[model samples]
Target: MKIRAAVLHSIGAERPFQDTRPLVIEELELDPPGDNEVLVQIKAAGLCHSDLSVIDGNRPRPVPMALGHEAAGIVKAVGSGVRDLKEGDHVVAVFVPSCGHCSPCAEGRPALCEPAAKTNNAGTLVSGEHRLHRDDGTPVNHHLGVSAFADHAVVSRDSLVRIDPALPFHHAALFGCAVLTGVGAVINSANIKAGQTVAVIGLGGVGLNSVLGAMVAGASEVIAFDLDDSKLALATELGASHAFNSKDPDCVEKIKALTKGGVDCAIEMAGSEKALEFAYLITRRGGTTVTGGLAHPEKKVAIQQVSLVAEERTLKGSYVGSCVPVRDVARYVSLFQQGKLPVDKLLTHTLTLDQINEGFERLAAGEAVRQVIEFN
Candidate 1:
């Protein structure tokens, strides 16, 4: 089928996103899914931090790649042998799929699945090739195996999650990555229980959801920390019990006081070494400190060996919140439909594909909450 797609030709070493400078938006031929694959027609796409990572050289995935991994739409076709899904079903594409046979998935850790995990790094089709090409049949880079930036994309059946048709397209898109990771971090990774005190650092899309997850999981005190007052307000609206300025004079001290010593868990979403340390400092003995942000390669988080020993704290790194897309995406959709997920107010910006650069600019400037690209 012929569809519209933004083709990235070459990314500059200084800035991978700058590679879109020679961007081309035209008709492209989408290869039909082979057995074990499914084709989807993207209705809404969210411009997320991971997508930004690839463009800004933070997460390099070769040149000439299609971007936008956070997206939702409808299944247009299913390859032979795919039994669970059918054409015309609403679905969200999981950028990372769980191949049940992989070591991590088989071990109950889908987040670290090796075979599917290596695709983004390899920059090859699941079968080790590209599924998209120019009208003239020239090959282009595939951003992640399931590139939702295009109006239509082919993905492994394992990567497609069926969602309710009652869910709004844009809201459904956020669940594809950002919301899932943040919420899953709280519910799945931390398993935060009632009355436990928790801190969410960095109130972006991920951090805010972490705060919501804490509220839902019954945290006694959900402290939200961020440099922006606007985001702090949003966090409060989303159920944070307390708010702290990221630059407050006594932010750490105040968090410690509120929890009567330290919080039970600290979720670091800013991806900065300093921010992670601040969260680490305010965690009580035997508490857990989780790194939820995707920090750039140039950035590093340093941990004090003494703190680990003296506090008996557990520091864990979570990827996409240890989610099993087939299971988690549907649950999130139900949450959104029942208004358990405060999505309508959380997503704050909309633009077209032509304005994607501006959307990313707002993301870099910290000027937007969640910017989405609308295709009509």
Candidate 2:
């Protein structure tokens, strides 16, 4: 079937994405789902920074690839050998589709499943097949096993988690990435205890979710930092106890003085080495610094080697918030349903497929929080 999708032919396109028009919408032919695969009719898809990274050349991937990852949809059909799901079921797209028998999966860390990473980097499904083709018969690469920028997708059964049909597609879509990564970092990676002081750097969708997660964990002080004051204000309104401008020359000192040293846990959601450095510096002695950001592959952070030993400071990297989607997605959704995780506040704008270029422009400018493309 021919379906409309946003495809990126090259990386590092000029900014003001609407002008350069990096993502070109095209009607591509989608093949039926293979064995153990499910065909999803994408309902809502979020414009995540990961997608922006590809446009700005911060992250590189195969060209002619469908570009959205975080999304929610309905199972239009299921391929042979699929038993747990059926047509009409609602599901969220998980970027990493773990092969249940991988070493990481056995260790309860599907986020790091080796095969998932391999296929993701290769721009194919776990079955190592391309299910999309251009009208010219050229294969289009899948993004993180879910080319959800399209109206439809054929993904591995392992790449989806069923959600309550009552949940709104736009809100449920965020759980696939932003909510999972941000909340997972707090609950799973940090295991933050009540009364702990936490600081989150970079107030985008992921950072704000981290603020909510810290509040849910009972953190007494949730410090929010960002270069943008509007984002800081939004963070404060959500749950951050304090908001600081990361651009301030005295910002680090302010956080240190406020916490009487530093925060118990510091999270960096901005995909920058400098943000990671700030997160590390604002962590208290014996505290943990967690980075959920995805910096360029060649970028590296320079940390004081002695601090890890002397202060017992732990600098850890979090992928998909170290989440087990089948479990975490439902738990987070339950929290959302109970009004504990006010993720709805993060939804700043909704656009149609035609307006997606501008949505990305807003995202690139830090002018929007979580923007979703709602299909007809």
Candidate 3:
């Protein structure tokens, strides 16, 4: 079948991405689903910072790749041996496709699936093949095994999770990444409990969700930090007990004073070493610092080694919010349905695929929370 998709040929091109046109819409041929794979018609896909990282070359990937990992769609067909799901089921794409046989997968940690990581880095499906091609017979790489920027995609059966058909497609799309990564970080990684004080640094889409997560978890004080005032304002509206601009020289000192030394849990959602370091500093003695941000592969943070032993400080890196998509996605979606998590408030705009570059520009400028490409 032929489908229209966005293809990124190279990385680190001069920005004003609309000018460089980093991702160009191209019509490509899609192969039928192989065994244990499924063909999907994408209904909605979110433009996330992870995608931007590839465009800016902060997170490197094999190019000539069709890029879009956070999405929801309808399963159009199932390949041989697929039994749990069939055609017509609504599904969300999980960037990490787990093969149940792997050690991490068996340990209930599919987010750390070794095979999935290898294939993702290699730009192929778990089956180790490209299912898309250009008109001239050139192979196109898959983006985290999803390649959902296109109207249609073929992905591993392990890469998808069925969702309630009643949920709006755009809303369901976020569960695939932003909501999962943000909320999961607080609950799974930090194990945030009621009455605890929490601080979230970098209030992007994911960061804001972390704010919501802390509030929902019954944290006593939820402090939000970001460079943008608008985002800070939005965070306040979404149940943050306090909000502050991270750029203020007094911000860190203010947080410590307010929380009395520091917060119990501090989350870093901005993919910067400085932000991670700030998250660490704002965490009190014996507290935890959780980072869900994807910094440059080569970047590293410096922390006082003695503090780990003296203060019993804990630092953890959260990938996909340390989630098992099969279970967590359902739990989070149920929470959203019950009104405990008002994730819909995060959807600031909806754009067509043609407007994708502009949407990314807004994301880069911290002007949008969550923007979706709503297919007609």
Q: What overall lDDT goes with each candidate model?
A: 0.80, 0.95, 0.94
By summed lDDT, the worst window of 10 consecutive residues in model 2 runs over 55-64
Q: Give me candidate 3's TM-score against the actual structure.
A: 0.99
| Residue-level lDDT for 269 in candidate 3 | 97
- Greater-TM-score candidate between 1 and 3: 3
TM-score against native, each model = 0.94, 0.99, 0.99
lDDT of 3 by residue, 285-323 (tens): 999999999999899999999998999999999999999
Residues 322-371 of candidate 2: C-alpha lDDT, one tens digit per residue: 99999999999999999999999999999998898999999999899999
Candidate 3: residue 370 Cα off by (Å): 0.7
How many angstroms is residue 137 displaced in model 2 relative to the true structure, after the best TM-score fit?
A: 2.1
* Candidate 3: segments with Cα more than 4 A from true spot: none
Clashes of each: 2, 0, 0
Cα lDDT tens digits for candidate 1, 1-376: 8878766555432323334343456677889998888898899989887877776667767767777788888998988889999999998877777778877899887767686778767765566667877777777666667777778988877777888898878888988888789989988888788999989998888888788778778898999998999899888888888888879878878777778899999999987788998889889989999888887778877778998988799999888888877788878777767777776677889877777776776777787878888777
**TM-score for predicted model 1 compared with the true structure:** 0.94
